[model samples]
Every structure is written in C-alpha cells, then in structure tokens.
Target: MKAILFEAPGSDPIFTDVELAKPQSSEVEVTITAAGVCHSDLHVVSGDWDIATPVVLGHEGSGIVSALGPGVTDLSIGDHVVLSWVPSCGTCRYCLAGRPAQCSLVASVVAPLGVLHDGTSRLSKDGRTLHHYLGVSSFAERVVVPVSGAIRVRMDAPLDVLALVGCAVATGVGAVTKTANVQPGSTVAVIGCGGVGLSCVQGARLAGVSRIIAVDIMPEKLELALRLGATDAIDSSSTDAVAALTEMVPEGLDYVFDAIGKISTTEQAIAALGLGGSAVIVGLPPTGQHARFDPLALAEADQRILGSNYGSVVPQRDIPWLVDLYLSGDLDLDSLVSARRPLSEAPAALVDLAAGHALRHLLVPSI
Candidate 1:
C-alpha cells in the first residue's frame, strides 16, 4: 500500500509504497478512508519531536474496519471508526481513573517506539521495518491499530468530516470541556486560529462562555474563529495579542488557551489569566522546549498551568458524543474542513499547512 514516510527530521516526507502486516491480537486493520493533516505530524517532519524513522506519519484519521484480530470482540469488520493515538489499556490505573490519554503503555512504550501496543511495526519498506506514528499511522492506504485505538462512531456521519474529531477536534474541544472545565459565563482566550485553536473556540462556545477571544496572526483565520464561536478576534499580526486581550478583558480572562504550542504563546496564555484562572497549554511545543512563568504570581493569584494531552479525552466516551453533536448540527464540524485532496498530494498539503494556507485538510485515499 502507499503511505507518506518521514525518513528523517528536517527533510520532506515522501509518498511511497510500503508493505503492511496483518493485524495482531487485540488489533484491527482499517482501510483508510480519510486522514486529517495535523500539526503533530508536522512536528515529526520538522524535527521538533524526534522519533524512529522510515515511519508512517499520520495520527488523525477515520476509516472502515476491514479486519479484526483476536480478542477484539467489541468491534467488527465494516464499522466506521475514528482513530485515537492514545489507545489505553482498560485495566491500567489511568484508564480506571477515566484518564485514558495518559495510559501507561502509551506513555512508556507505544509513543516512544512509534509502534503498536506490542512494540512492533506493522509496516515496512524495502526490507526495512518502518515505524508507526502514534500507533495510528493513518497516512497509508490502510493501518493496523490496537482495538482500543479504533473508536467506533455512528456509521451515518461522513467519515471524511469525522476525521478531524480524531485529533484537532478532540484536543481542542477536550481542552475546554474536559481539561479546563470552563464554566458557563467564564471568559476564555485561545491563541492561534489553526485547526486546534479554532476547535478551542468551538469548545468554549459549547461551554456557554460569555466571551470567547480568538487570537491569531492571520486575518482569514481570525474571521473563521469569529464565525465558529469567538465573540472577539485579535489579529496578532498587526497588534500585540496580550495587550489587546487585556484591553478587551480588563479583569483578565478566566481561561487562556495556548493552542500554538510556542513558548511565547504559552507565556501569553499564562499572563492573560485572571485571579484563580487557568492557563491551558493545549498545543504541543517541540520536545526540549520550555517556558518561563512567574511562580510567585501563580501562587499569589491561585492560578494554574495545566498541560492538556489529547484534550484529556477518553476516546470511547467522548468521540461518539462529538459525532452526535456533528450529526445534529450542534457542532459546526463542516466549517472546519477547508479542503480535501488525494492521498498522493499529502506532501504538498503539508507544505500548505505549514504555510497556514487552510484550516483542516483531509487526505482522502479514495479521492
């Protein structure tokens, strides 16, 4: 099958042929329908996050199940599913506590090795074993993932559109509703109007936030944020984002989300918080990157700096509900999709994404 391979950091990802092995026990093989291009994959390509290579590089996707492995009785062939990178073990402490995103196997093994739960690649190229990205590796025509990673959503929902719910939507919406738990009538600010950031805006709106402030350097993105749910927009290109946000919310924001994942935006999110407010770090900065903040201020004001991974989502519990929201029109997921391209155009799509050319691009294999 064809897949996009990132052989090394700081190099262009290649669209190439790869051999996919059959699914193992407690795993399932999904024929790729649509995969969402996300910044996390870019992080790997850009060398921001180091990983084993000759790796398939995509995590956010949706597809139809074609095969199921042993012990995977919960799902069956032909189920339309959304992929979750963090496929937690149900019996683990984290999963039992309703925190599957921080699953022990994912944290210590699957992620670092770029393989499935058993720590082996299901893909290979030219006699060399290829690594999986976040265990999903949905960039390919098909992927073999752990049963827990393939989340079954309603078959009626469009698989292409549902792809975003895998990552961007899950992370963004999860940060507000799950991680921060922003109360209705609270004020919120989200930096960066990309897929994740825009999702944050939508999540804030769904939480019934009184003021949803969206900040970004792009005018088009800011406009989109307003249309999504943001009550106010700040073009960081022409103005200071922090100063503008301060002017709009004199008392400071109840929750400030740094969806850009840069140290600067992370600091801005922290600085823009009100007393007892929380700064949700929803974006993933490059590995080894660090931010500086005033510890004294946080202590005095009773503020918090929360790191939200995968929006702290339990895919089994949350993905279905998100799909229902989309199907009911309560969630404007249709607006989030900017364009769709064939799987072969993934390299160019990544270039466009890095240039901030679109909101969310779907690489449809059948297209």
Candidate 2:
C-alpha cells in the first residue's frame, strides 16, 4: 500500500510504498477513503512532539471496513467508520470510570511506542518495520486499527466530511459542549481560528451562546469564523486580543477556549474570564511545556482552568450525534473543507497547513 513515510522529525514526509500486515484478533483492516491533514500531524513531523521515526503520520480519517479480525464481531466488512486515536480497553480503570479518552492502555502503551496494544508494528517497507502514528495511521491507503479505534458511523455520511469529525470536529466541538458546558446565551471567546478553533465557534453557536467571539492573527480566518457562526472577530496581529476581549465583555466572558495550545494563549484564556467563568484548554502543546496562572485569582473569582483532551469525547456516542447535525444542515462541514488533494499532495498540504494557508485539507487516497 502507498503511504506517507515520515523518516524523522525536521524533514518532509516522503511518499512511498509500504507493506501492511493483516489485522490481529482485536483489530480491523480499513481501506481508507479520506484523511484530514491536521496540525497535530504537522506537530509530529516538525518534531514538536517526540514521536518515533519511520512512521505513517495521520490520525483523522474515515473509511470502509475491508476485513474483520477473529474476535471483531460487532463490525462487518463494508461498514463505514471514523477513526479515533484514543482506543480504550473497556475494563481499564479510566474506561470503567466513564473516561475512555484516558484509557490506560492507549495513554501508557499504544501512543508512546507508536504500535498496537500488543506492542508490534503492522506496517513495513523493504523488510523494515514502520511505526504507526496514534494507532490509526490514516496517511496510508489502508490501516490496521484496533476495533475500539474505529467508530462505526452512517454509511451514507460523506467520507471526506466524516474525516474531519474524527479529530478536529470531535476535539473542537467536544471542548465546548462536553468539557466547558457553555450555557445558552453565555458569552464565549475562542483563541486561534484554525479548523479546531473554528469548530469551537460553531459549537458555541450550537449551544445557543449569544456572543461568540473569534480571535486569530489571520484576518481571513476571522472572516471565515463569522461565516461559520462567530458574532464578533478580532485580529490579534493588529490589536491586543486580551484587551480587545476585555473591552467587549466588561466583566470578561462567561467561557473562554484556548485552541492554539500555546503557553501565552492558555494564560490569556484564564485572564479573559469573568467571575465563575471557565477556561478550557483544547490545544495540545508540545510535551514538557507548562503554563503559569495565578492561583489567587482562580480561587478569589471562582474561575476554572480545565484541560480537554480529544474534547473529552466518547467517540461512539459523539460521532453519530455530530453526523446527525451535519445531515440536518446544522453543522457546516462543507465550509470547513478548504481543499482536497490526492495522497501524493499530502507533503505540500502539510506545508500549507503550517503556513496557515489552508483550513481543513483532506487527502483523498482513492482520488
């Protein structure tokens, strides 16, 4: 199968052919239809994250189940599914506690080694093992994912659109609705206008927030945010984002989201909150980085600083609901798809994404 091989950090991904092994007893083979070129992929490629080399780099994807493993009885061949990076073992402590995103096996095993729960590589090139990225390396034409990572969705759902829901949509919208729990008619501001950030704006709208403020350094992105559902937009490159937001909501916003994952933005999200407000950090910053905040202010004002991973989402429950929203014409998945290109163009697409030139670029393998 053809795959994008990231030989190492600080180098461009090379388009090459790879060998895929059959699915294990707990896994399923998927013929990938579409993969989203997300910033998280770029983070790995750019060495922002300490990921292993000679790996297939992508996580957000939608595809059809090509083959089912021995123990995989719930899914059948030809089932359309959206892939999620966080695959949970149902019996784990976190899973039993209703937080599958923090599944012990996924966090402690699969992610660090870039392998399956069994700690083995399913991909190879020229007789050498190639690592998997996040257990669902969607950059390849086909992938062997654990059954838990593949969430079955409507077969009629557009694969390209569902591809975004796997990550960006799930993370962005989940951050607002599930994590922050923004109340209706509340004021909210989202920092960063990338795909995830824009989805936060849309999520706030869906939650019936009256004042949805979008902040970014790019003017074009701010305009796109308005079209999606932002009631106000601010270009942080020209003006002070914190000061501007403070002026808009004199008592500060009821809720704020930091989708950029920068130390600065994380701080701003907390500082721009009103009394009893919550600031949810949705972006994944590079490992080992930390943000500083005033504990006195948090206690005195009854404010909260929360961390949301994968939008604190439960894939099986949320993906279908988001699909319904799309089918009903409430969630605008079409506008979020800025460009679509073949698998060969993925390298360039990553460049454009890092340059802030594209919204949600889908790499269509079949096309």
Best by lDDT: 2
* TM-score of candidate 1 on Cα atoms, chains taken together: 0.98
Candidate 2 lDDT, 15-58, residue by residue in tens: 99999999998999999999999999989988889987789989
Cα deviation of 275, candidate 2, in Å: 0.5
In model 2, the Cα lDDT at residue 348 comes to 96
lDDT value for model 2: 0.92
Give the range where candidate 2 is weakest over 10 consecutive residues by summed lDDT.
153-162
Residue-by-residue lDDT tens digits, candidate 1, 1-367: 9999888876789888999999999999999999999888888888888788878989999999999888889998999999999988788899898899999998888899888888888899889999998889999899999999999999888889999999999999999999999999999999998999999999999999999999999999999999998999998988988899999988898999999999999999999999999999999999998899999999999999999999988899999999998888878888888899999898888888899878889999998
RMSD of 1: 0.9
Q: What lDDT is reached at residue 317 by model 1?
A: 91
Prediction RMSDs, each to the true structure:
0.9, 0.9
Query: Candidate 1 overall Cα lDDT vs. reference?
Result: 0.92
